[model samples]
Target: MGEKQGMKGYKLAIGLAIGAALLLPSAAGAAAAKPSYELEWEGGGQSSGTVIARGGVSYIAAKAIASEAGLAISWDVSKQRAQFDGWNKSFAVRVNSDRGVLDGKNTEIGGKPFVLNGELYLPVRFIVKALDGDNVKWNARTQTVTASGLGGYHARSETHNGLTFTVVTATGELYVTGESGESRKLADLGDTIYGAVKFAFYDSPGGLLHLTVTRNYGEPMIQYRVYTAVLKNGELIREAEAGYFRRFVDNATNGGGQLIVTDGRTLELVDDVTGRVAESYDLVKLGGEEDDYFVEGVGPEYLLIRPNDRGLLMLIDRKTGGKTLLYKELLDKLNQEYAETNDVPYFGDWLRFVRRDGDTLYFRNDAPIQQDNKLYAYKLPE
Candidate 1:
């Protein structure tokens, strides 16, 4: 009986030891895993490099690097060769099966080298074109980049009402549609037309379409001011004076049936029936200082405004002067995460709140917000 009891105790101890040994490896593995990229702004340019052991990648913008070795080159670890490309050129490169680098080159500009995180990364335009084809174009005026021959893909450049517009298309019919029930052949713009159209209020409610027409007065002193025009039945009529307006940030119809314009520091709440200002106030004054306050979006019930340097968001009621905070704690959390002192990129600023469905606010950002190479989703508290 004593021997049997001793054998049972030994077996139980062995089982416990085995279970702990199995858990130790898993715990170590979980602790070792981390994000694959790190983003840092060094000088001015931006570049990204892969991390080997930790699997952390680093990305720096184009303006951060000093000089390049003929378009920075990185070793293709998967294929075991050197690769290169252009900075800010919309292209990608990878190693071929034959141990050769495959890439499309942009024939327009020469390549430059960029260093990031102690490693060199070349622009994709040089490498892709060198290995693949020479069908790539970049339009700086419109801020667009394009490549063809790999199934032919194009992306249009879009922005708030501005002087510049850019788009990229390859061998396909370009279509232009307007809210004013106007359709025009985009090819008619020009042979080198490479961007999207910039109008004052295509995406905004009660917004007008403004077009820039350049005429040669044959005099060196030619002055032009930005003008607003209402588009109806494909015709521009009812012109309004927009004083040195840079661009339309956000415009919407309020609950009181008025159009609110968030133009820089001035917030003009216009009467819906008449295109006249009903009530207007300087947002800078409300914020207690001359801060860079811009209206982000205007919902049916609320107006979202971002005050510069405050890092705190404010919501104004359309009906009353009552103000509420939308996830102030989240903004604080983001600031703490970045360890920023004055200004940090607010996820709310990047995102456009579209609709309030149930208890959630649906929003989308114009550009991809990335910390390292990995993506992050913004979460607001209830």
Candidate 2:
């Protein structure tokens, strides 16, 4: 009886030891697992990648970002650095360092890059900004980071007088949607590149619709031809003319005057009713070149000139013959917004003129580097 009782006790102890061995590995595995994040693109597709935590900051694999952004990447093991080249630019990052080289200039990154299990990890936002990626956002609740590749596909719309004009870039179709929520096709602007078309309501005796279309070819050099068209009463009155550059200048009737270039160095403002040159401005004498600059908007007192390389706007005062740099203030405001929204300062690449309403001028940064593209209204200097 004693022997049987001892045997039963030994068997019970062995069973308890086996149970503990099983539980030990499971507890260790649970502790080792870290949280992962999802990466979503503009195309509505998503992939999962490992998000590592270091010193309270989040880092993602650099290779993963390069893959999504279509960048070519290579590692220099001796230098402890990685090079990413794309979008006509190159960026290099080194491990254990916060300094990076973008396009051959030194720039500061958000955090030092690190390696984990043979994969290079970097701050995702820093890489995105350096590569001129589209807007990136992090959703902590969803554990997801959404981003768009450089030159992501998008549709655009403009509103004027309670009507919205929408351009579908993929199909090169233009549609006008009225206040009644009804939409109809207006024109077929065949095979134009993205952001190659602009529309404005011309104030004239008949209030015509003005359109500028740019056709581009020859990549890397980027040669383009500009075309202009006019529509009266939803019918195409004037077809697109080649190489004709013109804009409607604001006038007293809340209408616009046709501003055109008469000679290489002379800009003429023509009266819309009579179609005659009312006034002319000599661009060369005004310290501007006709080829390097284009008229963005003309006010009662000044004309806004934008550079061809998408630099700052130059304000030319008609009365005083004074030139004032206009976009520094606008760029300051944009940087503030960028710091708030993108957690980084704005990089000035392109300043786009949105429109003008009375004494207020609206502007936005268009390409290469941009924030959410919020229109900022700057009251014209009186």
Candidate 3:
């Protein structure tokens, strides 16, 4: 029961330490034209290199990748090997050999490394996979490789009850790593999963973690499903029915064993332990049906909501049952900033609620292409 931070669209802060290698099969006939590949870091930075095709496999200069990816590289002229060291892991590749040593274990890099113009060149897929195991993608059309630096998925680290844990939203495989560096696979969420939000209930005996995963399907995304699961002490305790909303909105709990939920029409205070509704509210009757209401955060005396497509936020008085419009000016400013650059009207989805820490609330303008990706903060009104 303190102010819980909302983690909806926050990026995970991970470096080379957390990423591991996974071999990616090269596309057959990819090197017919001897195409070059471009490596792009999601946040910023870019590097490009000429691709060397060997038996239909693509390799790129290792020096260019190591510099851009922040990897420490050491070359051994006598041994004809290049060693890459990150914060916590190291791997070595030898020229004219497909065999490599990853963290002291011999592994197949899938393609051979070679010296071209006195520079060591390694397989593009092998270099990316080994550094960041599952967080990379190869685009054949553009001949580009996008490295998200997020381990190929969204992750969040949190500390509770003096113990730290990291939850990874690796699509189809949700994993949690404890303070002792032990990882436990919580569930296989399926392939359509795009993102997830987790809540750690530490008051329970062994702690209960609730994960709400979102999935989308169809060419135009005609359908959406939100899966809910609860895990206790690394064991899955509950895998319930589909969630009520198209988007899994934020929830608030008070350890009094009650949680807040909504289906964009009615709001319910449900028991956290037992799947029972304690109280329900007809939101449309209080306001109107024009807005697709979703819970953003819950405070002691009020609930925050984004009336979808309205370009404003509403604060509902939980005790007095009154309503107040807040943060319209902030939204307009963000929209103007986006409009000036995007050359199109600002869509409501571009603005997202990041989190609420104490009396401060945070928001981010998630413009797909923008120079500034900074978080905006607004102090709550007293």
| Deviating ranges (above 4 Å) for candidate 2 | 1-203, 207-213, 227-265, 287-290, 333-349, 367-370
Q: Encode model 3's per-residue lDDT on 7-46: one tens digit a residue.
A: 3222222323233222122433454435676665543456
CA displacement after TM-score superposition, residue 366 of candidate 2 (Å) = 3.2
The alpha-carbon RMSD values of the candidates against the true structure, listed in the order shown, are: 22.6, 21.0, 22.5
Each candidate's TM vs. the true structure?
A: 0.32, 0.35, 0.37
Candidate 2 lDDT over 197-286, as tens digits, reads 555555465365555545444433244444444545544444332332232221111214563433224556655544445688875566
User: In model 2, what lDDT does residue 292 have?
Assistant: 41
Strongest candidate by TM-score: 3
The whole-model lDDT of each prediction reads 0.41, 0.60, 0.57
lDDT of 1: 0.41
- Predict model 2's lDDT versus the native: 0.60
337: Cα error in model 2, Å: 16
**Residue 337's C-alpha lDDT in candidate 2?**
48
Worst lDDT window (10 residues) for model 3?
8-17
- Per-residue alpha-carbon lDDT of model 1 for 103-214, expressed as tens digits? 3432332334344454544343443244233454544443233333222223243433332222333322223445442444332222222323333343225553333321
Q: On lDDT, who's better, 1 or 2?
A: 2
Q: Which regions in candidate 3 have their CA more than 4 angstroms from the true location?
A: 1-60, 63-99, 102-105, 108-174, 178-257, 261-277, 280-286, 294-306, 311-382
